[model samples]
Target chain A: MLKYLFAAFLISICLIVGKALAHYIGFFPGSIYGMLLFAAILASNIFDEAAIGAAIAKIINIMPLVFLPVCVGVIQYGDLLQTSGWKIVAVGMSSTLSVMALVAFICAKILRDERCD
Target chain B: MNAVIEPIIFCICSIAIFFSWLQFHRKFPFALFNPLLLSVISVVLILFLLEIDYSRYMTGGEWISAFIEPGVVALGYPLYKQMHLISRLWRTLIGACCLASLCALTINVLFAKALGIDEWAIRSLATLNITTAIAMETSAEIGGSAALAAVAVMIAGFTGSAFGMLLMSVLKIKNMRAVGLAFGSASHALGAATIARTSMEASAYASTALILCAIVTAIVAPIYIPFLLSL
Candidate 1:
């Protein structure tokens, strides 16, 4: 239980750090930095996972649910979507598929080369 | 008094709906019942029909937002474990993600311009490849609609997960490593999770690609988008 508290405490610190960075950088997503910073701490062994691994996993599992509020904000864009919904979907779908195809093609080529080697 | 009541209602409604959907998802495991998507739909309907304001929904919503950063950071452990495999493909992975980010950003911007989309909406689309938290932040930074960014990211995730595998099979690509990287780069965490059940290595690569792609987008989009706008 103490370790679990520590895990939450550590994450709070990261969030605070992310907020601070936000003040300086115009486009910096402090949260991404927070995760990277925490990951660095974990990678460097500054934070011992044995203390809070299970707790963190359980917290992360509900990560999707956390975004529901933000997703619901889509309701605000009713006018925008009404006018350009299909166009935006077209762009999103095409771009998403484009990235997937490109990444997969590159990975497949690299893997095939590794096989040849 | 209503402030307190509203927040309480938001929490109760969100949690109750999310939990019930999660239970159902566990039993059926169907893609159609994606917990996040369903929760958003249910909550939106509740807010609209009950005449609850978005700000009130945000009161409880703020609690969930508070966890976004830490939750993403917690992913560090699995990523650390997967570091060895990731290192072997580091150069390839980096190259692939960089190109993927470039393509995703560029395509959206071009489409927006051609369609004469509102500049704000275009800004949201610019960072669609990043995680929802970061994407929303980036969208707000560039004067875009944060809500639209979140929605676009979800749409991208659902699209990739629903159609990605079919696309792969059509291409006749049999390697799990490639499959995982494609989904992760395109759809972020949801895609990564979907592929996780297939094989451990694939999931590891997926996680790696997910993190790397987000990092790359965070770094590249600000500089790239402005440059594109100038052009």
Candidate 2:
């Protein structure tokens, strides 16, 4: 219990500092900044990995639930979807397919060459 | 329906519905039966049936949404764990992810424009290939609706998880590294998770790609999205 609280506190502090930096820099989201800061701390060994592992695991386990409210906000945009749902779906599917194809082909070619060498 | 308890009820209901769907999903293990997608549909249906205002549901819903930012920050731990792998193949990983991110943004923008999507939706679509949390943040940063961005991300994620492997096999992309990176870069976490069931090596690569592509897109979207919009 105490460990979970400590983990939360550490993450919150990182998030707060990250948001402040984002506000100052006027680019990139604070969450990403916080992510980078947290990673840096881990890399630097400022805290033991075991200390936050369980707490972070618990958080990640429920991560999908966290997006529920925001996704539900889609209900408010019914008009937008009604007007352009198919178009949006088309764009999403095509772009995803294209990107996947591009990355796969490129990696296959490059990595294959490296293996041959 | 009491105003004072409404928010709490909505929050609890959302949690219950999500966990219930999650259990079902675990047992069924079907790709299309995404717990989030199903839960959203269920909640939306209930709200519609009840004639509840979206805002009223949000009053409680925002409590769950509040955790999104922290959850994203917690993603750092997984990324950190993969640092050794990243350090070893940093060059290839970074290069592939950068290309993937830029290509995804540009293609999404072009397709949205061709489909005559509105400008705001185009911005939302710009981050479609990124994971949910980063995609929403990047979308909003670029003057798009975070909600719409979530919708777009779900679409992209679902499509990738469903068809990505088939598409790769059809394309003759058999390399595990390539397969992992492609799915991760294009489909984000959902794609990575789907790929995880097949090969542990590919799963690692997929995870690395997922995290790296997200970072790349978050950095590149702010500049590239606007530039694409202008064109």
Candidate 3:
């Protein structure tokens, strides 16, 4: 129980830093940057890997958990979508496909077959 | 109850829904059919049917948010293991990072213009490819709606995953590096997660894309966005 709380404690710190940094430094996604900060500390030897491994695993298990808050709101605002909603969806989805294709094409064309690896 | 538990409940429902989605993700393996998209759709449908105001859902949200920090911290290990690989692919990763953000930015705006979308929605859409945190900032920086962008980016990733798979088939992007980068750019961390399931090498390549894209998006998106608005 204490271990779980410890893991939660660490995550709270990251969120605080992430939220703060997003407001201040205007850098990467705050939570993500906060993660990067945690990453830096871990990688730099400030934190021990084995000690945190089990706790980290529990935390990672719940990482996908955060997407929930936003998903709920999309429902509340459903009526706001309108005719433009589907269009927005179409453009967003199609652009993703095209962007992927365009990127792959550009990379293949730019680099020789041999050096790509 | 309304004042204290609103955020907590909202959060729990969100995590519960996504957890089920990840389970489905195990079987599909196809980028386009990721369970996250379905999960989002399902959540919307349920909320619509049940007529939940979403505010009530927030009551339990804190229950889930407690994990956000540890999750980010845990990722350090993956980044650490793959740090050397990142050093080698620095140039390629950097290039893909730039190209990815620029393309996502341009396409959303230009397409919005052609479609007659509003100004608030325009800036919100700009950060669709970026992760939620940055999307929030991107929305604020461009004088758009963070709430809109946050929703937009999540949906964009879902749609991007679905359509991205189709494009991959058409383009026949058989190479792992290209495949990984394509996934990383269009989907962000979620894209990388899908790639990781495909193969270890593929995951490694995707991680490089993930790290590079995150850093690059951070530096460039905010700077480029305001200028794009000026134009």
Every candidate's DockQ is 0.66, 0.82, 0.50
Go through the candidates in order and give each one's C-alpha lDDT: 0.79, 0.89, 0.66
Which segments of candidate 3 are over 4 A away from where they belong? A1-7, A13-33, A109-117, B1-50, B62-78, B140-143, B163-166
* Model 3 agreement with the true structure over B155-217: per-residue lDDT tens digits: 666765556556776887777667777777777666667667666666676666655565566
Please report, as a residue range, the 10-residue window in candidate 3 chain B with the lowest summed lDDT: B64-73
| Per-residue lDDT of candidate 2, residues A1-117 (tens digit) | 988998899889989999999999967789999999988988899899888888888888768899988888898889989999999998889989999999999999888866321
Which residue pairs clash in candidate 2? none
The DockQ-based CAPRI class assigned to model 3 is: medium
lDDT of 2 by residue, B1-231 (tens): 487699999999999999999999989988788888899999999999999998889999999999989988998988998898798888889999999999999899988888888998898878999889999888988889888898899888888889998998899899998999998999888898899999988888988999999999998888888888888
- Residue A107 of model 3, lDDT score: 59
For model 1, the stretches where C-alpha displacement exceeds 4 angstroms are: A21-27, A115-117
Clashing pairs in 1: none
Judging by TM-score, tell me the better candidate of 1 and 3.
Answer: 1
Error of 3 at B192 (Å): 3.0
